[model samples]
Target: MKRALALVLSGLVMACAFGQGNPARGVRRPPKLQLFHEVNLSTFWHQAIIRQLAFSPDSQYVAVKLDPVLGTTELVIVEVLTGKKISTLRSPEYLGMSQNDRVQWLDNQVVFLGSYYRWNALSGERLADAPVVGWQAIFNQDRTQLATVENVLGTPSYLHVYDTKTWSDKKIYADGLSIGTIAWTSDDHLVMSVGVTRKSMGKTIAGHQIGRGPDVGPDVALLLFDPQSQQFIKSLWFPARARKTAKGIEWDISADLMLGISCFGSNSVTLSVNKILDGRTFDIKQFYSDQQVKSNSVAMVGGQACSADGRFLFIKDVDSWDGRHKASNSIIDLALSRQVASFPGGKEEIASSENGQFLAFGGKKGISIFLLNGE
Candidate 1:
């Protein structure tokens, strides 16, 4: 018996030293995230920075949010294949393209899902009839519908819903309440953060700013909305004090829970796991920070995005930030609940193409596009 026990002990030590018992030790790391494209903002143009990015339906083009020039806010379009500046939608200060802004393409024209009117992507014209341009635009589970407020200044308050096939909408009362973050729940419901209103504030026209503010959370809370019927649902509240980051909130959802990354600053973020049924908060304030990456890494909230098919969520985290920033994106497989891979991550904004073939990231400096190893 003593001899046998000694042998077992030896085996255990060997296993510990060689990582024989751990499931993750021998697993292969994901392929390095390839650079699909890059926009260098270091030329004579000093004031311009990439605020956000959107890929066209066919993924042939990408829209850079706001200015290629500082004082002017234009919808800059770039061809994905050739990296050429194809066009600009002139200056429309309201077209922020931030996480809060939901503008999308429809009928070959730029329209938020809620089509009160449409903006032309090529012409740079804000046309009158959304009779196709449109979300300041948020999409539901299938991207079939979009939830947006009226874009035309002083237009009657309405929560617009575009069902892809037709328009389904209802007028709203609190349309002027600033929107911090907007997300979709598993039941196909809308979840968002309501912030202070601007009806009488500094800015004159203020309604199209939903999803652009900070998380109105000392505690994680949500103002639920039912789009099919166009009704505001009950507010759900939680106990976790929302950590302050910069701006924007990114969500990954399941049947009973939601994974929300609330951006506090460039360095601080919280991966708040919430109970779907009752709005309970499970704080992972140090989730990525305490992660086993180099220890000094930080995640950028704008870089947190899920694939359109909902299979994976990619988050950009920095490994180093001295002068030349070293960053990589962490791809989490939602169904399996594991970090399956890591890609490049330093870009300020990230968006996945409709077919998921390309991942795009944008920043003040410029934009970088990448592809998964196999693709």
Candidate 2:
């Protein structure tokens, strides 16, 4: 009976009709954020580091990738409401992989693209032998297709789309660009941040340096593409410093907004938002800046996530030298342009459910889930 219910829930999840409700609006008090549950990785193993987290499409479960110790990694599936471990898969070969190798959910099945291998979440089954050699991997809304970048030396980065059913892949788009974040906005259309290299360094693409140093690459611009026809659709808004390196990009499911981050040297990072419209243009706005967040010369916005309704944005401060470490994690109410709450020891990684009812955080400390109440 349990397996049967899971099968039914899986179908609903793929249809994107599992969770449907308007998220609560306005500023929510800190006290209203009740701790829904906590998953202590240390309890299962030693020196555990929660690297990546993703909520199931139906919001019934969460998949967590943890490095219990150096040179080892594991994927654990947990029931969200009960906080019970449903399944666990271990891979000793994934030693130095970071959160960039994410775990995705295709209905009830969990798919993980590791540094050198791919595996199933529940049964510990190996699906593919090749590693995803790219910056990031993203699945479509229905989980029928997967998209990744092929960044080979001395060649343009090519976008690869793989059909899950046939296991066949096709190189759709290729360009002399450094691709940052990649996502499928719809079944037919995809979004990505692409930037031109500063100069030709022989076999090496120039100006794509990530951490520290001068912003080598031209400013990254968000673009939309059609994977089926392999055609560039339109160019969206670019970041403020259109000549810096863009490190990350995220979509706010609730408000149809895009959040982008550009890192300057080793200490500074900027966050911006743009509302995606029906046409090609985007309504861009500079939402938050880390220029003033520095304390003792160590301040940076490590990670960020938005509620489904796009009312609240969660920002995590990493490497803050502030003695107190009081505002490690903060909740910003976008409508009011003010901070609502702050928490100490917040992780740099966060995730939210489609309905915006739950928020998940992962870090060296452990995993935490919070329930957002209506204001």
Q: Highest TM-score: which candidate? A: 2
- Worst 10 contiguous positions by lDDT, candidate 2: 261-270
Q: lDDT score of model 1?
A: 0.50
Write the residue-wise lDDT of candidate 1 on 1-375 in tens digits.
Answer: 546644654554344445433346545433234565676543475645666667787776777765555465556677766567766665445444444454356544463323343567766667655442234455554567666654444332345566656655544554454444455554666655543344512322222223323443222344666776655656544333333445444231211123353221111122432111222222222333233433434433445655655555667654344644456556765434456776544556677677555677764467777653321
Per-residue lDDT over 183-249 for candidate 2, one digit per residue giving the tens place of the 0 to 100 score: 5553346666565443322222222332222343223556667777776676543332422235445
Question: What are the per-model numbers of colliding residue pairs?
Answer: 25, 3
Instruction: Give Cα distance to truth, residue 352, candidate 1, Å.
Output: 0.8
State residue 289's C-alpha deviation in candidate 2, in Å.
3.7
TM-score of 1: 0.58
lDDT at 21, model 1: 35
